[model samples]
Target chain A: MELYHRIQIQDVVRLDHAALDAVEAGFRALGQGRVVQPPILSMAIEESNGEVDVKTAHIRGHDRFAIKVSPGFFDNPSLGLPSLNGLMIVFSAKTGLVEAVLFDEGYLTDIRTALAGAIAAKHLSRHDSRRATVIGAGVQAELQIAALKLVRDIDTVDVWARDTDRANAYAERIRERFEGLTVNVHGDMASACREADVIITTTPSKSPLLDAGHLPAGVHVTAMGSDSPEKRELEVSVMTCADVFVADTRAQSESNGELKAWAGKTMPFEVQELGPVIASGQSPRTGHDQITVCDLTGTGVQDTAIASFALKRLVA
Target chain B: MELYHRIQIQDVVRLDHAALDAVEAGFRALGQGRVVQPPILSMAIEESNGEVDVKTAHIRGHDRFAIKVSPGFFDNPSLGLPSLNGLMIVFSAKTGLVEAVLFDEGYLTDIRTALAGAIAAKHLSRHDSRRATVIGAGVQAELQIAALKLVRDIDTVDVWARDTDRANAYAERIRERFEGLTVNVHGDMASACREADVIITTTPSKSPLLDAGHLPAGVHVTAMGSDSPEKRELEVSVMTCADVFVADTRAQSESNGELKAWAGKTMPFEVQELGPVIASGQSPRTGHDQITVCDLTGTGVQDTAIASFALKRLVA
Candidate 1:
């Protein structure tokens, strides 16, 4: 007899530090060349203003893997529906029988994405970092900061948005969530990153938002908003000025992330991957005066990792 | 405010002639260049002899599309489990919201594949064809013969299998299904095609089973088994002898079907697609003695079409 399990969003919302660690381990395995991840299968539904992407990865010696179907329809919001929704289908790697279906409705994607941001901060940001800057006032802005709290002692936050009212509202929510932390709303991106130990960009802008002049010495920048070819968060000059630059996956970074501006051009510095840094137990940012940048375009390894983690927790 | 409907195998078993017609229309659309189908995403799990394939297609101007995940574990039968299992997820094209999930196992695949064979026979075979020859006594052998009855007046079946006992048993089942129809078990493939109007091969042999010498004049052959690079059901000589050669898709046929034998080699004929032939309302087989061959490698449009058809019936 065959058995199937369906895990809903409520079950997945309870993820914690353990889930973050699981995703980090997936990155480590990928850096060690122990995972098989294929190029994403993307299809455009032009009439509906929608796109669907199928992603999967197999970790060597792992008992299970996941195939995630993620679809985004830009017109969904007008119909009173969320723009992003889909599920992850998990199968036993040994027998290929479906072990479970995570009907997360994009919750797991949010969790894994935020956790990836935290993973980058943990390996590149200063250990005693207490001030952080967020470049967007959306759902991801809050989640990315919350995830960073797991790895650092962040006690102050600087928020910046294209609209002042949205930024102020975002600051109020942050103050309510973190009692003793100070939340300051900034009018410009330059002011928000001037004095912060870690800066994160979470906007879906088609043009570059942050440049080299916006960065401060000894700061770590995590660009999490650009995950498509049309999106860019950091300028090419910013990447070139940084002492060290890392990517979640070099191929994805060059195609869809902040590094896209420098895609076919050669650079003076060697590009490092986040997975190898975590696996090797070394921080690329060795001094307090060195600038470091990490570009995350997401990977299938993270989906398989997070799905496996959620299944274990829900089943238990 | 999200709703999900699950249609099980029991619900899909009620499919009738309308479902077959819906799939035929999908082929017609594909032939007219009104469908956008991405290449299939396939992954192999070597340890368990398992492979997973993700197929999807968007029909122009349709309200919804489908993404089907099909997994095959060859070793499952040893553990008393079915060798194939998976589901189809359908999303609304207007809003990209998942409208339904069809947990029909592999029933939808079986339905679409069998209907594709019927569609090929409908457009390529002689209008008065009455006798059919099936080269393998598998589930598809029974389904193909049954589906062909929708377009032709098939009253007699010649069953051939590697094992004579299985062929005899298959003949018995066909006799019970269609009263007053003559069914014969043949020991060799040549004898089965000696006096038949339509021939269908449904086996997983890693070799050539039928050659030009096995085919008689005016016979239409539908090879539905060789869906992988290592599998072949017909020899190159048979294709060279046919007056018209049709493929479900030229790319897939060249890689995983009987056409693989002619890959990288120049052929005397241009390969036609089944969809265009049906849409043009013209049969390439001009004379009663012309030999026609169709290699059915399957396509994502069939999955989307059949899933949409099943959802309409189940909801009504």
Candidate 2:
């Protein structure tokens, strides 16, 4: 089997129009019930304070699919190594032969995840939106803004992080990359999101950081972190108050994202998945003053979609 | 990072004592409650008449773990390709970094599976055994006999299959391989198993093939092929009649093995996993006339164990 390194993959996969469309198509297939996705196969290695997740999906009729293996060793940063590293194995959906081994090392995941946030904003946020308030100053915090630009004319970013230095550093780097774009570092999350058209939570915070009072009117919020049972970025009131509550997948949202606060209780209102909502082509955001929230804990279909897209570009 | 092809893996891994012991140690860890194994993540591609299974386990304190991806495209044989092909990814338990990739293409799984049957017989079968009966003239039917030789003094074989020519062919091959061993191709299932000291059912039959009447006194029956919901090889009476009933893992067995026969209902006897039996250093087969049965549904720890062992030999 052919093995492609991170450099090769980085050259091919991007948080651009084609990649976003590919991922959106995956959600469309998933919404149409043409995708075969199993529950995430997760293993915890307590001795190392690490976790690994194996995810796969087969979009019916698609010629190719992908299985993603992602590992996160939290202690790696302490050892001067990156905390997350992994790869994707793309395969022929018809014959099960491997198409390629993409040692992208989680690059595709980062792109796909950021794109998912953009997807939610595209369908739920106001069309004339121009500013994004990003929580956390990580790689995702930067990529989320870049991806949001594909769907909306985003030219400004408000950054908030627990670490002021990291937030300021993020502002400097993003401003350099996105020329002439406005960048502001906020000391408080409420102020960061006070006048934003869209809000994105990209922190690994284990407590609720964003709530109804912090959300601006007509703002579309994408909580892209909080993918574990212990992590929660949005308070229950935020979900309860949103005019449109979207989950990437309800099962995953309930298990890992903002919806965990209402895990067993009956939902106060109808909750729709981002897939079916996008597939319907009818925006749930019918009014400009609506609060839209999407809990994107991530899904296997995104991995499969991004990997398939990566292979197409690499082979081309 | 290092990808080892089938030949490279074959050169290092074998169905021998060390390999068997490694696999056994995995089960020992499992039985000792020192292993973290999740349920198999399975996906089916109906368009291709194919299925894929992803399995992995973390043996606490072990330096490494393995995630195995196995694919079976049943229609491949119709296209003149082998029906099974896949690989294993071995990672560092400490840092979650890629150590090696075993592109064994299901070779390691075959060895680990066959060795699991041998492990069962070694712990549950009578020690003073010489003759054997293996139903189904498939790859496993042949490997079971070769693996059985590691723990028993097998000198005679009784084979039964739906295909007469294939059964006769298997008889010819094992005769040449075992060198002067008596080989008998039986016309019926009952007679094939009547006088055997060890009776192994290795077919993908959706219905039961072995029953109480077919089991000889002191015979140890290892049903190794029923690893799916619709597959069964032994009748309920056979399990009830056996002095001890064993499963590789009760959860897997309940979902995809002989234990599926009693999936919802409680079994008539105490069912133990082969691992605990080995770890305890006590055979449930106390009497020579005792009929012991083991359901070998396979496990993630076996894959982790075998792949870790394979890497050790390759790096050496």
Candidate 3:
């Protein structure tokens, strides 16, 4: 009899960069029509002020499993706990049996999202880009940097946060983690936004954070946050300035952020899907100074891709 | 961090009779709106002649969680293995934390289903009933026997199967495990159907196994096998003769067995839900000779109820 293995979140904590790399490959595999991802079902708990989602997918020639319990951890600070919890189960399609369970829900989410950034940047970011600015010095902030490094030869990283101490700490961590990479702790948000070849925002704020006027020409901004309707990370003016705007899903992005603000209005740009860009090589690295922005709303395909990839790595 | 423990299937076997009690309590809890079970989703693999389903449920007042897996064990007989496989997970609604992982997918499915029979019999079975004829002695056949014992005082059980050896083996096992019960093996299906005050069928066949004309008066038949559209345990004539026909869900029954046959035509009878019957004291138990049939197309509510109850039992 084949036994189903249950893995706890406490069992695997440090599945960081290596896991993200595997997840990136999964996305590519998904684009190749090698995976089947069902629509993600999200349950937003208003009373608890949090949300949880269950994502299912069938990775053809890879894995058939669903990622359950990707619940947003809220009350972590007050409860003295991490801000995310849950498990992912890999079930076999051959026998319709749950083969393994992984407990690192938050870490998995982090890596998958970061891998998405890496994928977007690999196709979208300029080849000569060396500096990147990251807003929101939180858990996701560090991951964005890690993912960016895998795509571009990034040397200098500008970090900004509401809490200067946290930003400084994040900068220190980046310096220690990435040897010979200069970590610049910016005092002002606008200063962090300007003169960077690439920029990523990973904040949970409802209003815009960066000043649009501060952005240099030809900058590639990846809005890594702003997942729901209430979230808007990029300034409304940034939407107008962006030469080409790309999104993980046009529907999801249109309801959230600057896209929501610009929706139904006459905008000079066209919304391109991430999958098509990856599929047709449409997301090309243009000239040295072409402005680009990718608004990622996080699709079910990413979950399917990551799950399919992880299962293969585990079994192999 | 709260950790969900895993109970491997090998650690526990013969979870048949054990689940009937829990299933009964779960039904009561379900009527109380303390459980939330979505409808069961399935996909039939036509080429392989197999089916896969993802069964999920959320039980209220016990920390919300859904049990998910593609459980397919119908192919086990051909593979020389148990045909059922899947995983049961209990997750927290408040924190989105997975609390427990039970690896006995098909075992739990069988147990909960049999328990539903026991629950149905507890309210619908004949009083002073001392005999039961199980139509098909497959996996759930023995469980139905155990479940009946909890609700009715049965002194003898007549077992019938397509294969005589399988029927004899089932009868001997029941006799060994359950005290105060005599096992009688039937030469044919009608012999068992002729004497039974309560009839139970647990086959995966598409055609009717027993004759409606052979059924004795006042017998309560619990049809456990016909859940899918292509499967059934009773003939259309038998349903027409039933005085009271109760089902888990009227909508689901219409798509499955007896109802599927009676589609576009008036229902054999106006169906009553199990919830209202259990909540109200109006369940008719006038005598030991009322021909009542409760066709159970297993609901997601049952899964939620049992999963919640099991979690409580584990914690306590």
| Top of the candidates by lDDT | 2
* Deviating ranges (above 4 Å) for candidate 2: none
**Which candidate should be chosen as best, given DockQ against the real structure?**
2
DockQ of predicted model 3:
0.25
Give the per-residue lDDT of model 1 (tens digit) for B1-316: 1222334555654335777789989999999999999998888777788888899999989988999988888999999988888888888888777787776677889988999999899899999999999998888988998899888999899989999988999999989998888999987888888998999999988998989998888999999999888899998888999999999998889988988897767777889998899889899989999999999988999999988887776667
lDDT of each: 0.87, 0.92, 0.71
Q: Report model 1's chain A TM-score.
A: 0.96
Residue B217: error of model 3 in Å?
4.7
Per-prediction TM-score: 0.94, 0.99, 0.78
Ranking by TM-score: 2, 1, 3
Candidate 3 per-residue lDDT, tens place, A176-216, comes to 98999998898997788777999998888888886568688
Of 2 and 3, the candidate ahead on DockQ is 2
Expressed as tens digits, the lDDT of each residue in B1-316 for candidate 3 is 2323335333443344455555655566666666555555554433334455656554455556555554564666777756776666666666666677766555667767888888788788777677998877776898888777877888899988899999888988888988878889989777777878888888887987655786898888888788888887788777788877888777678776557777667874777767667866567556656688888878766665566666666555
- Poorest stretch of ten by lDDT in candidate 1 chain B: B1-10
- Which wins on TM-score, candidate 1 or candidate 3? 1
Candidate 1 per-residue lDDT over residues A1-316, each given as its tens digit: 1222334545555436888889999999998988888877878898888889898988888999999999989888888988888888888887777777777777888889999999999999989899999999997899999999999999999999998999999999999998998999998888898899999999989999999998888899999999888899998888889989999998888888877787678766789999899999899888998999999988999999998888876677
TM-score of 1: 0.94
